[model samples]
Target chain A: MERVVTINLNGNAWQLDEAAYDALRAYLGAAEAGLKDNPDRAEILSDLEQAIADKCSVVLGPRKSVVSAGEMQAILKEMGPVTDSEGFAEGAAPKPPVDVEKRLYRLRQGAWFAGVCSGIGAFFKIDPTIVRVIFVIAALITQGAALLVYLVMMFVVPSAETSEEWAAAHGLPFNAQEIIDTAKKRFGEVAENQNRMWKSAQKPPREPKVNAFVSPVQKPAAGYGARMFAGVVASVCALAEAVIGLGVIFVVWSLFTTGAVLGVEAPDAWPLWGVIIGVVVASAFVTWPLRAARRAAFGALGYDAAGSEAAFSFFAFIFTVGGVWYAFQYWPAARDVIEPIWLWFRAIIAPGGF
Target chain B: MNPDEKFAPLRKGLLEFAILKVISGPAVYAADILARLQGTDFATQEGTLYPLLSRLRRDELVDYEWQESQAGPPRKYYRLTEMGRAHLDDLQAYWRGLNQTLDNLGTFGGA
Candidate 1:
C-alpha cells in the first residue's frame, strides 16, 4: 500500500500519494524560486496554488479519491514551468542557468554569541573556532572594542532562517533540487562538528550544551523586516539606559564626595549633612525610573516586565515620601547652601562685576 | 535543432500580447483566460499566466478585483487599464506594419 499524504492547496484539501506530494511541493518551490526577483511573488504564488487546487478537483472523482503520482506529473507538465517575465509555453527550451549571489548571514543553528564569528567563518570558508579565537584576541588587544563590534554585527547582520538564505549563506545554488538537498542535512554535519570542537576545547570536564548561551530566550523565527525592527528598538533602549545609568551614578558620586570632604572639615556643618542626605534620597527616586525603563526594554523583547516594575514602584514610592519628609526637617540647612550659589549665579549674570 | 526550441522565444513574447488582447475585451478570470488560449499557439500553463498577470498589475497595465466564484475560493478577475489599452493599440499597429513589410518583401526581391 502506498502512503497517502493530505495537503491544503489554497483553501481546498486533497490527498495525494507521498511521491506526488513531494513533486507538487518541489514544483511550487521552483515557481517561487523563479519569481524571487518579482515584487508580487506572494500574490502570484497564491494564484498558482489556487490554480493547482482547481486542477486537482477536476482530477478527483467518486472512484478515485486520491491523486496519483502519474496524475500529478501530467498536471505539472500541463501547467509548465514559470520563467522570468514569460509565464508558460508548450515544450519551451530549457531555462538558462541564473547566477546566484552568496551573502553573509548569521547561522542560527550553530551560533555561540549572536553568530557573528560563525557568519564570518561561513562567508570566508574558515573554521568558526579560528574566527572566535581571532575575535577574542582582537577584543583583548582593542580593550573590548571588538566585543562592541560583535554587538553591532549582531544587530546589522540578518540570521539565516529560510531555505533560500541558508543556501545563499553556504554559497550553494538556490534551485529546487539544491534546496531539497540543503534544507535537510547539508548544514547538519558542519553544526555537529562545531559543537564537538567547542565541547572538546572547554578545560573543565562538564556537559556542554551546544547552544548553551543562545538557546535560552531564543527569539521566534521572524521575517527579515520584523527582526531588523526589533534590533533597532532594542539598540535604542540600550543606549538610553546607558546614558541614564551613567548620569545617575555621576550625580551620586559627586554629591557623596563633596559632602564627605566638607563634613570632615567642619563637624557642625548642617548644609554638608543635607547634601549627603539628599544624595541618598535622590538615588531612590532615580532607581525607580531606571528600573521602569529596564522593564520597558525587557517587555519589548517578549519578557515579563511586571515583576520588576511592581517591586521597584513600591520601594520608590516609600523612599520618595521619606525623602520629602527629611527635606522639610532640613529646610534651614538647604537654604544656607542655596544662598551663596544664588548670589554667585546673580553676580555672574550682572553687566558689571559685583 | 527542434522546431519547438526555434520558436520558443517568439511564442513567449507573443503570449503577453495575446493575454492583453483577451483581457481587453472583458474582465476575465485567470482560468477563463487559460481556457480561451488552450490548444492555441500561445497556450500556456497557469503557472506562467499568474506571474505575467502580476507583472502586468505591477506595471499598472492591468488591475484585478476579487469576485466570488461558484467553486472554491474567490477568483481574481482582471481587466485592462487605460495604459494597457494604449499599449495594446501600439502593439497592434506595429504588428500590422510588420505584416505589411513581410507581404511587400517579394516586390523588392533584390536578394
Candidate 2:
C-alpha cells in the first residue's frame, strides 16, 4: 500500500504515490540546485517541469492517472542521470551537479555559527577547519570584535541554498559528489532531530510534504538583493520614525511655551487649541506609517507581530480618520494664517514664483 | 590506471567542442544532444555533461530557450552563441594544425 498525494504542477493537478513523489521532488530539487547560477533559472525550471509533465502524460496515457515509483525511475532514466563533469566520483555514481556561480554564500546545512568559514574556505580553496582556526585566532587578537563582524556578515553574506552554492562556498567545483553525499548523511540526522521536533509540534514542520531530496536545511535564504531591499526599508522606516517623534516633541513644546512652530505664528496658541489639534493630527499621520513600516520589516523575515500589531492597527486606523477630519477643519483657518507665510516662503524658496 | 580514467579529461575537454559542433547546426534539447553524442567517442553521462553545459552558458558560449514539447515539460533547446561559434572555429583550426604536425612527425621518420 502506498500513500497517494495530490500536487499542483504548472497549474495542473497530479496524484503521485509517496515514493514516486519523493523521487520526482528530489529530481526537480537537484535541477533547481544545478541551475541556481543561471540567470534564467525561473524559465529553465519551469520549462523542465513542463517537459516532465508532458513526458508523464505520454507515459501514463490519458487512462492511467496515478504516477508510480517505477514510472518515476523510468522518467529519471529517460532524462538521463545528472552526474559529475568528470566521469569519476569518489563515492556513489555522482549526485546531480549544480554549477553555481563561483562566489561565496554561507550554507546553513552544515553550519555551526554561520556559513562564513565554509564560504571563506570555498572562496580561497582551503579546508573549513583551517578557516575556523583562523577565525578563532583573529577573534582572540581583535578582542572578540570578529564575533561582532561575524554577526554583521551573517546578514551581509547570503547563505547557500543549493548544493552547487555549498560547493562553491567551500572552494570546490560545484560538480561535487562529496557535498551531496555529506548532505544525504547530514540530512538523516537533521530529519531525525526534526522528526522529534515535529512530534513535539515546536513549530510548523519546515519540510514540504513531498520532497525527500530537498532537505529542510538546504532551503535558500532570501538572496542578498532581497536582504538589501529589506534593509533599506528598515532604515527608511527608522528615519521616518525619528523625524516624526521629533516633530511631535517640537509641536508639544510649541503649544505649551510659544505661539508658533518653525518661526511661523500659530492661529490659536493654547495647548488644546486648533493649531495644537492640527499638530496632534499630523503626529498621528506619521505614527500610522511608522507602525506599518515595522510590520513590513518583520514581514521580510516571514514573521508577524502578535499583540502589539493589533493595537497599532487600531491606533493607525483612528489617526487616519482623525487626521482627515483635522485637515478638513484646519485648512480654512490654516490657509488664512499661511497666506503671508506663503509669500515669505516663496521669497526664500522660489524668487522666480514671487 | 584504468583506460576510462585516463581518457575522461581528454573526452571532457573535447565534449565542450563536440556540444558546440553538434548544436551549431540546429537547436536541440539536452537529451537530444546526448543522444547525438552517443555511438561517438565523446559520449558522456548526463551528470557529467550538465555542468559543462552550465560552464558553456556562464562563459557566454551557449544560450538556451524553453521550447514547448509534446512530452511532459518544456524542453531546454540549446544553441551556440556568437562567441561559441567563433570558439568552435578556433578549436577546429587548432585540431587540424595539430593533426598535420603529428602526421608530418610520423612521415619524417618513416619516409
Candidate 3:
C-alpha cells in the first residue's frame, strides 16, 4: 500500500499519496518561482490553493478518498505551465536575467565509483586522477582515515543530476543541450555496465567472464604508479589532519591543567579567572581558523560550505581581541606559569635539554 | 510563425478586456469565468488567471468580495470596477478601429 500524507489547503484537509504530495509541492514551487515579479504573489498563491482544494474535493468520493499520483499529475497538468499570459508590460524596461552562481556538485561522468574525486577535480580545475591519487596516499597515511572521509563525502555531496547542476559544478554558464547530452551519455554507460553485470551473474562463475565485465571500467588515462603515489600522499594528509586534531586537544588539556596548578600555587596573584578566560579565548582563536580551513577544504572537495566561513571568522576575531587583551594585562604572570611547562615539554621531546 | 505562436500575444492582450466584459454585468466567481472561457481562444489556467486578476485589483480596475462557498473555502466574487469599465470601453473602441483597418486592408493586389 502507498503511504498517504494529509495536506491542509485553503482550510480543507485532503489526503494524498506520498508521490502526489511531492508532485504538488514541486508544482507549487515552480508556480511561486514564475510569480517572482508579481506584486500580489501571496494572494494569487492562496487563490490557486483554494482552486486546487475545490478540484480535489470534486474528485474525491467514498471509493477514492485519497488523491493518487496519476490524479495529482493530471491535476497539475490541468493547472498548465504556471506562467502569466500578460506578465510583462510593453513599456517597462527589461530586467537582466539573474546570474547563476557556481556551486559544487559531484560529477557523474568519468567517475570510477561515486564521482567524489571527479567532483573535487572539477571544482579545483584539476585532473580527477590527481584527486584519486591524493586520496589513496591520505588513506595510507592515516591508516584508512582518508577512506572513511571519502565514504562520508560520497554520502554527503549531491551528484549533479540536471544539465544546469552539471554546468554549475564546472563553474560554467548553462549550455543546455550539450551538457544534457554528456549527462545522458554518462548514465547510458552506467546502465550498460549494470546490464553486463546482470548478464554475467546469470552465467556460471568463470575467470574470463569476470574479466570481460571488468575490462570496460578500467581507464588507461592515468598511470598505475601515479595512482599509487597519490594513495601515499592522501594517507599522509589524513595523518596530518589527525595529528593536528590530537595536538589541539592536548594543548587545551595542558592549558587548563597549568591554570589549575597556578591557581593553587598563588590564588591571589595569579588572577585565576583571567588566566582561564585568556586560555579559553586564545585556544578558540587557533581552533576556529582550523575549522574554517577544514570547511574551505571541504568546499574544494565539492561539498556545500553553506557560507560558514563568515561565522567562523567573526568568532575568531572576537577571541583574538580577548586573547590579545589578556596577553597584555597579564603577560608577566602568564609567562611565569608557561616557562616551567615549556622546559618540561622540551625535556620530554628532546632529552638532554638545551 | 505557427498560427498559435503568432496569435498568443494577441489573445493575451485581449484577455483582460474579455474578463472585464465577463464580470461587467454581475459579480462572477473565478471558476465561473474559467468555465465561460473554456473551449474558447481566451481559455487559460488558474495559474495564469489568478495573477492577472490580482494585477487588475492592484490597478484598481477590478475588485473582489469574499463569498462563502458550500464546496470549500470562501471564494472571491470578482466584478469590474468603474475604472475597469472605462478601460474596457477604450480597448473596445481601439479593437473596432483595428478590425475596420484589417477589413479595409484585405486583398493587397500589389507587393
Candidate 4:
C-alpha cells in the first residue's frame, strides 16, 4: 500500500506519495529561500502553485486517489524549478528585465468611480462592466474591505496616460512609450488640420465691398414647426421599436418556459428575419439621436461620422438587450397572445422561429 | 592577462557591463535590476549595487532617467554618457592587453 500525504492549497486537497511529498516540500523550501530577498517572489510562487494545482485537478482527478510519485514530480517539474537550472527542465526561460520608465501613466478614460475598473479592464483585456461587477461582488463579500482598497487605489494609482502606461502596469516593456508618442503626434496633426479648416471657414469673404451687415434678426420661430414635427416622429419611432423588441422577447421566453413545463416540443424554426428586422428597427431608434449628440460633442474634435456610427451600434445592442429583459419581467400578460403572432410572423418570413 | 587573471576582471567588467546595459536600454531602476538579476550569482545583495550605481551616475560617466517600475514604485534608469563610453573603451583595451599577456605567459610557462 502506498503511503499518502494530503497537501491543502487554495482550499483544495491533494494526496501525494511520500516521495512526492518530500519533493514538494523540498521544492517549496527552495522556492522560499530563493525568493526570500524578493518581495514579489512569494506571491508569484503562490500563484504558480495554484496554477499547477488547477492543471493537476484537470489532469489527475480527486484528492483521495493515490497520486503516483512520478505524477507529483511531473507537476513540480511543470511548475518550473525554484532555481534557475531547474527552470530549464520545465522549459522556463529567463525574462528580460522590465524597463519601467516608459510604461507608467495616468489613465484618463473609462472612469466610473476612479478609473480603477477601466485601468484593470485594460490590463487584463476584459470588459470594464465585468470588472466592475467582480469588484462589487468582492466588495460585498469582504464586508467593505474591498471597497476600502478600491478607494485607496483610486487615490494612489495614477490614471494611465498612454498605452505605455498600460503596458507598464501589466509588467511589459516601457518601449511602448515610442508607440504612444507617435499616436499623440498623429492626434496633434489631426487637431492642427481641424484648426486650419476652422481658420479658413472664419476668414472674411474675398469680395471687396459688401454692405455692412444688416442687423441680424432672430429667426428661431421660423424652424420651430419643422423641428417639432421631427421630434414627434423620432419619439414615435423610438416607442414603436422598443415596444416591438420587448414584445418578441417576452413572447419567446414565455413559450419556451410553458413548452418545457408541459412536456411539449418547442417549435424548431429559424427566426432570422424577425431578428434582423428587430435589430435594424431597434438600432435606428436608438442611433439617430445618439448620432446627433455624438456629432455635437465630437465634431469640433475632428471625429468622423463612421466612428459615431460604430459607437451607436455598440450602444444600441446594449439598449436592445436591456429593453428585452425588462419586457420579459413586466409584460408577462402579453406573452400568450403575442406568442402565436410571433410564431406566424416567423413562419411567414422564414418558416422557423428560433 | 593569464586565464586566471582574465576571469576576475572579465567578471567585474561583465557586471559593470550588465549594469550599464540595463540602464542604457531603458531606465528600470536599481532595485528592479537587482531583483531581476537575483538568481544569477552575479551579485548577492542589492545594497552594494545601488551605491556603486549612484557613484557611477555622480561621476558623470553614467546619467539616469526617473521612470516608474511596474513591480512597485518609480525607478531610476541609468544611461551611459559620452564619458562612460570612453571609460568602457579604455576597459576593453585593458582586457585585450591582459588577454595577450596571459596567452604569452601560458606558453612561456609551459616551455
Q: Once superposed on the true structure, which residue ranges of model 2 sit more than 4 Å away at CA?
A: A9-12, A30-51, A78-354, B1-5, B45-51, B65-76, B109-111
lDDT of 2 at A67: 87
Residue range A1-354, candidate 4, lDDT tens digits: 334566665445666665455445444544444444453443444444554455556556454475665676566655543433223224333333334443222233445644678777766656878989999999779755576566435433544432234455554432233333433444444335432211222222222211111111112111223333433343334344445555545444545445421344444463544544554576567656644654433222222454433433433454465444445456875455445656767998987556
Compose the digit string of candidate 3's lDDT tens values, residues A1-354: 345677767556788875566556655555566676777766776788787777787789988899976677677667664565344333222122223455656666678876889999988889999999999999788766676677545434655643345655776422223323443444344235432211221222212111111122112222223333433333333334444444444454555666444234424565756655655577567656555555544343323343233322433343444443445456986556456666778999999877
DockQ of 3: 0.30
What's the distance in Å from true for residue A177, model 3? 14
Candidate 3 regions with alpha-carbon error over 4 angstroms:
A85-354, B106-111
Worst 10-residue lDDT window, candidate 1 chain A:
A195-204
Which of 2 and 3 is the better model by lDDT?
A: 3
Error of 4 at B59 (Å): 9.5
Chain B, candidate 2: TM-score? 0.87
List, residue by residue over A134-211, the lDDT tens digit for candidate 2: 999998897666765665465456666543445456544333444344445444543454322112222222442221
Error of 3 at A11 (Å): 1.6
Please give, for residues A1-354, the per-residue lDDT of candidate 1 as tens digits. 445677766656688875566556656656666776788876786777777778888999899888976688678777777665743444345454343566778875677766878888888889999999999999889766676677756655667755456656766432344435432433343235442111222122222223333322323345555555655554544444444544454454445546333354423555755765665577667655655655554344333444334423433443334433444456876555545545666888983766
TM-scores of all models? 0.43, 0.40, 0.44, 0.24
